[model samples]
Target: MVKMFLDFVGDKFSASNPIPVPDNDPLDDCSAISHGTHVAGIIAANAIGISQPGFIPDVPFLGVAPEATLGAC
Candidate 1:
C-alpha cells in the first residue's frame, strides 16, 4: 500500500482560498503507456467474476486496497 501526505503552507492557505486544478486528459492506452493506471487498478479493482480464461481460474485479479481512494498529481 502507498501512503501520501499533503501539506499546505503560508497564510494564503484557507478554506476560502481553494487551489485550482487544471483539467487533463487521460492517456489513450493506459496499459501500454504507463503502469500508473495498472497499479491504481491493482489497488482498486473490484474483482467481480472477471478472469483470464486461458491463464488462470477461480481467483480474480483483486487489488491490495480495493476501497482505497485515487488522486492524480
Candidate 2:
C-alpha cells in the first residue's frame, strides 16, 4: 500500500528530479527521499500496519497530524 501511494505520487506529480550533483553521496539521496517519505510514512503507516492505533499500545507515537488533517492552508 505504501509502495502504491509512493508510486501514485511519483506518477501524478511530474516534478523534476533533484539536481544531479557530481559525486553525490548515497546518504544524500537517502536523506532527500527520507524527508518526504518519512512524513508520508507516519501519516499512513498505522492504518496500513497490523495493529492500527493499538500497535504501540504503550509508547506514544507522533502522528503526521496531531491537530487537524493535512490540507491546503
Candidate 3:
C-alpha cells in the first residue's frame, strides 16, 4: 500500500532525483546513495521468487503487494 515519491520532478523543487529536474533553483541532488531507489523498492518492488545475496529470507525482499497488479496509476 505504499507508493514512494522517489523521483520528484517539478519546476519549483526536486526530491534528490537521479536525473536532472530542471527549474530556476539548483538540482538539489543527494549523496545518500540510492535512497530513492531503496524507497522505490519498498513501494512496489517484486521479489520474483529468487534468492538474493544479502537478505536472509527466501524471497529476499518484497513490497506490500509484491506480485500484485493495479490498473490505475
In terms of lDDT, which candidate is strongest?
1
Which residue segments of model 2 deviate by more than 4 Å?
Answer: 1-33, 47-55, 58-73
Cα lDDT tens digits for candidate 1, 1-73 = 4443342333343478766332232212223466777678877887768776694778666688888877533
lDDT of 2 by residue, 1-73 (tens): 1111112122222346544333322222234345666675576434422345546655545566544343210
Displacement of the residue 27 alpha carbon in candidate 3, Å:
11
- What is the model-wide C-alpha lDDT for candidate 1? 0.57
Which sequence of candidate numbers ranks them by lDDT, best first? Answer: 1, 3, 2
Once superposed on the true structure, which residue ranges of model 1 sit more than 4 Å away at CA? 1-32
Stronger candidate by TM-score (1 vs 3):
1
The lDDT for every candidate, in the order shown, is 0.57, 0.39, 0.53
lDDT for predicted candidate 2 compared with the true structure = 0.39
Sort every candidate by TM-score, greatest first: 1, 3, 2
lDDT-superior candidate, 1 or 2:
1
User: Once model 1 is optimally superposed onto the true structure by TM-score, how far is the C-alpha of residue 61 displaced, in angstroms?
Assistant: 2.8
For candidate 3, give the lDDT of residue 73: 20
- What is candidate 3's lDDT per residue for 2-73, written digit by digit as tens? 333333453434355546555443334454587756665677677767776777766556697666543212
